[model samples]
Target: MKTELDYLAELAGHGRISRRAFLGRAAALGVSAAMMPALAGKAFAQTAVKGGIIKAGLQGGESTNSLDPALNLSQVTFSFGKLWGEYL
Candidate 1:
């Protein structure tokens, strides 16, 4: 079920409500003033990406570190393996 905040968020997300109106309604619903901006920003943010390649660089890996989990030694290698490896 949707609450007042959820409805407000939806309205804010879809640009159906102005920021001032959203904040006013949210304030009436007892939301903190400090949290209003964050809530509004989250609602206004773009949707997540459907699919994409993710690239990352870590500094702790060494030439001797193996990508194999069983042979992993450094934290960077473990993190790299976790990023590329799939598990059930």
Candidate 2:
């Protein structure tokens, strides 16, 4: 059985609740303000996912896009150039 504190902690971990709100609710539930940090830490702990392909759809791209950094006029070209170390 899950307690209210556990529910609040899970909500905080998943970003469903703000830090301030979580702290407030925990306090209302008689949790010590000082202990809030430790509880909050547990609530916020997360394991990073190992691998996945991330995709984003950005507007402002054109068929006439140029690879040259200097000629980058659209957001897509600019982002692509920056990611491939073109700006460096």
Candidate 3:
């Protein structure tokens, strides 16, 4: 017979269940209580941290290239510089 944990795991795999509901059901079924916070913590941990500066170094621009936007010859460098320049 499949257990509640198995059902919960299936639901989780399908993205049809929330972490809180799954953990609550698991705990009700006498599953390890420790796993509740651990799983929740892991779920929260997977989230990305917000508001940080991102720097990228792209290679392609030649010495002749100027910081002037009109003189941009390399599309890659031009876009890269333009993107980072917005944050400055």
TM-score of 3: 0.39
lDDT tens digits, residue span 1-88, model 2? 2388888888898899988899889988889888778776766665766555536476877888877989987779888777655322
The lDDT, on a scale of 0 to 1, for candidate 1 is 0.78
Tell me the lDDT of candidate 3.
0.65
What TM value does model 1 have? Answer: 0.43
lDDT of every model, 2 decimals:
0.78, 0.77, 0.65
* Every model: Cα RMSD to truth: 7.1, 8.4, 11.1
- List ranges where model 3 is wrong by over 4 Å: 35-49, 52-88
The best candidate by TM-score is 2
For model 1 the local lDDT of residue 67 reads 63
Error of 1 at 50 (Å): 31
lDDT of 1 by residue, 1-88 (tens): 2388888888998899988899889988889999877776666665655566758789976778866789887778778888877442
Off by over 4 Å in 1: 42-88
**Where does candidate 3 have its weakest 10-residue lDDT segment?**
38-47
